[model samples]
Target: MKALLVIASLVASIMMTYAASPSLEKLQEGEKIKVRYTSQGCFHSSNYLMDFSPNKVSIYEFLDKKNKNPTKIGELTLSDGDTAGLDKLFAFYGNGKEKIGCTTVDNISITVIDKDGNTKATYHYNDGSGQAHRLEGVITLGEIVHRLRP
Candidate 1:
């Protein structure tokens, strides 16, 4: 009976770990922000601007200052069933440099699709240390937008 109880406890612990989502900090108003993904064996980053009104959330990515790039990556949208309350989306924008003879960017988009091609979660990218750097912090869209506002 003791062995069975131990096995059940172990299973419960594993399930809790899997069910827990990444902890996110509450963003204030306006700020420039970045997000990095470090799970499994993949790494990516994304950058963007954030703004919020009383009832709406807006995320903007400056591709070249000519037009605003608007799209959600992965589970970065607050409307996509993300109880975590993320309000902005960012993508991996390369710093216009090459590393180790390979092209790399500092942004990424986390997109989830169903088997039938339906859209799922879209997450933003911040920054990933890649094979050398490790990011240690949580960024919020409100915080970034707050910093950029005049």
Candidate 2:
């Protein structure tokens, strides 16, 4: 009986934690979504950005590791299917301020902005083991964006 009770309590606690976690906000029409990836190292560092807005998608490469002054590398007009796919993927990230930091050389961040230019939600996560594993979704998003690079 004690074991059963402990299991039940654990389950309840986990449920509560999930309930409190921020979920990805739904993307509205004309809303903009941006994903940024930065990689730093002792000798080399780089930053990449992907922007999704309405029916368009743009990718850029930053000249420096600090994510400043990006030069447009590619731009594509999203087809109906591409837009739908992007919306589905972004929705996977539930809305809220999700900031998970770890000691690592790679970082991924996502920002959603309303049509009025108001920030909706921002998520930043570093790539590492342990607690950093919780933000694997951000890493996955980064990989997707990388594949989109032209």
Worst 10 residues of 2 by lDDT: 129-138
Off by over 4 Å in 2: 1-25, 40-44, 77-105, 129-150
Error in Å for residue 37 of model 1 = 6.0
lDDT of 2 at 85: 51
- Residues 1-150, candidate 1: write the lDDT tens digits: 999999999999887644432222333233222332322223523345433322234555454534356444222234332213342122112232233422343444444334455533444443333322221232334333443442
| TM-score per candidate | 0.25, 0.51
Per model, how many backbone clashes are there? 29, 5
Model 2 per-residue lDDT tens digits across residues 1-150: 999999999999876654342222345677887878776656656688878777666889887756589998777775565555544444343334353353446675777788999886676655432232244333343444455652
lDDT values of the candidates?
0.37, 0.60
The residue-level lDDT of candidate 1 at 140 comes to: 36
- Give candidate 1 regions above 4 Å deviation: 25-34, 37-84, 87-150
